[model samples]
Target: MDPLSDILSVLKLRSYVSGGFDASGEWAVHFGSHEGIKFHAVVTGECWVAVDCEAPVKVKAGECFLLARGKPVRLASNMAAEPISLQFLLPPTHDGRIVTYNKGGEFLSIGGYFTLADGQADMLLNVLPPFIHIRNEPSRATIRWCVERMRQELCDPQPGDFVVAQQLATMVLVEALRLHLSARDRDEVGWLFALGDERMRAALSAMHASPGSPWTLQLMAKKAGMSRTTFATRFKEKVGLSPMEYMTRWRMILAADRLTNSTETLSEIGHSLGYNSEKSFGTAFKRVMNYPPRQYAKL
Candidate 1:
């Protein structure tokens, strides 16, 4: 698996809930705080999105965005519109089905939220921004398939709509991340965004493929086809960390996953990740994770 795939697989999904809001004219809906990634796409018209304490953003038709953290969401046709709780707007009986605020038709959106398993969300979640805004045109072509399918499933409710909508929402989340990677119009920087760069991706893939390998800066530069100096500079600039540092972090992450899921002894886990002794592995784990392997497992 590639780096993204490896991290996603480790961050196993728990459960999902999806719903839609259709409103027209002057209106605002406040979606309360939740502990999961919230994703939504505009099906028609436009609205302003305020995730958490950040500034309001105008989301145009055909555009989509993912709220990385489970912060409160305030969506409005006008930012100043008085907020209305989604719960009061839609009774428990009609939840998950499209509900309207006032005369519906002008502003329509379909979205969902999902949570990852315990003790593993930080691998990717921590690397992402508060919200990722993916515009149409280029990104649309990449995830339009999932988006269109979701639009259909959301607009017309049928048998098993809940399950199908949740499945499609998950697809949208993954594809949206992939789309953000491919688009070149953004100013975001990090390991997640660095996957967009071809050379950086090559080096990252090498690290993910054989994290146990005794990788040096020179070896990583070779994978990226650059001199050690250039590779080190560019990797730090693009990934926000030195090449070897990233390798160590990745190894520790893999070690943590093993610690949580595998029955391997500390010595076995350390050796598998290229540590010569259990002490060295424990030290590194403590440095990166702020806890010893055994203690982390207990938590």
Candidate 2:
């Protein structure tokens, strides 16, 4: 398989937001939830982030956090400590505007928002500890450089700097994820480790290559060179879904994309995805997505 294509297929570039702030203050940002992922970096100063949880998380410079499920969250400086200068990243909206605040002080920071295009991204997300701190470590030099470049872009505000900054910030996010994966414990077992396994990887490849295929536990187990019971147990333990369940999710994901990007008839899409009829596909799609395929397609 083409690793590059595999990587690109599972990852998507969203939007990046970076800024500097002086003094302690609150900033409100508006972001619509998409079936995507989000990564935030505290490039400079120190701040606190609160996301529908009790209290806030104290995040220092060079540290990063991810909201892989695209939940809405709030970020602010730590008022209890010294006033923080801060910067952040987020996914771009249709208007290309990021909601934020600068309370007039010396602060520098950068942030990027991205979507996981493939299953690999989900693997990477799973291995990351709640918050990955990259402070005062030589291994974090690359992250430091990304932070510095973001500061320069914010300070200079040159032509197209906004675009350039966002692109670089996305790169930084990807690199950070790569670093995290490399440093993860070898004994760590999760969907990520499963994906790295030759047998499991091959199984996943088959499923993704043909979500509509009439997949069976025995067939999948044979493909993975394991007993059916072992394959089912292992697949469930790692993926949190049965093989058939995962196939359904995958089909829905593809259906959502097609609904948004294509003009195919519902019947055609349903049949292509292995549904016996458009009505059956529509029923399953609604059960999973809470909207009929045709209605969802319009959105």
Candidate 3:
């Protein structure tokens, strides 16, 4: 698999918001929008997640739930069952889009947008489950700390408090994801686990270390200490792409970053990445990115 693609799958490129609501006698909050990922953290209250397609999932304090794919869900408190307060940490938009929150009573939350500027974050996203419910496990100290920091930042009326709070909140989410990947079942292979494997890690490192090298299946297989057929099959199973396909994707990813961050001529970038000529590089770049190199660079 292309490490860049894997990483992007994990890094959510959307806006986020964090806040809380006091449930007075079974009040319910309905979130109905095709926005970004929505995360509900039960900081001090209890609630139930009622969705149309699935049974209602109960929530309690110190537990966090993610509503992936921005599916519409309802959160409610049933006084007849349990008494709980509701806190939410959610994206502000879907797909870098914008979201508006009509401020309710003393809701304490933080939110921000996430984008994968590099391969690391992208690899993490691909392995994450569609919805992750994190119990207050022992290994989640970092996540807890981040969440507490978010609460502190949200409460503090300091200048740039929102900015600081949002950053912390984002960090918390990232850490949570990291914890999830580390503890995820080994049988459920995801891109993150693939990158972490010894063999795949070495191959990926080699590719990144020398993107312009004449990488071949034989060479990669040798580096991985596996037979050519074994290497190819394993790589495909783990990465969801052939070796050359992964290489091409990585090259395009590097090219896009260069286009955005550097002033190098397109031809120079092409040559740097082992392209024979500017036109050849341009064609490859366009095919992968759906934009001319120069045009993409301007963005």
Best-fitting candidate, scored by TM-score = 1
Q: Point out where model 1 deviates above 4 Å.
A: 13-17, 52-55, 117-120, 155-163, 184-188
Clashing pairs in 2: 10-117, 10-118, 11-117, 22-105, 87-109, 88-111, 89-111, 89-112
lDDT of 2: 0.62
Ranking of models by TM-score:
1, 3, 2
lDDT of each: 0.82, 0.62, 0.63
The 10-residue segment of model 2 with minimum total lDDT is 82-91
TM-scores for every predicted model: 0.88, 0.64, 0.73
* lDDT score for candidate 3 against the true structure: 0.63
Per-residue lDDT value at 225 in model 3: 85
Off by over 4 Å in 3: 1-17, 34-36, 50-52, 79-129, 185-190, 291-299
- What pairs collide in candidate 1? none
Error of 1 at 235 (Å): 1.4
lDDT of 3 by residue, 1-299 (tens): 35434444333343344454433443555666443456656666566776546778777666677655456667666524532222242353432212223433322222333444443343444455546677777776776676666666555556776666566656666666666666677666655566656898788778877888888899998878899999999988877778888888778877887777678888889988989899999999889888888888766
The predicted structure with the larger lDDT, 1 or 3, is 1
104-135, model 2: which lDDT tens digit per residue? Answer: 44333455566664433554455445444444
Select the stronger candidate by lDDT from 1 and 2: 1
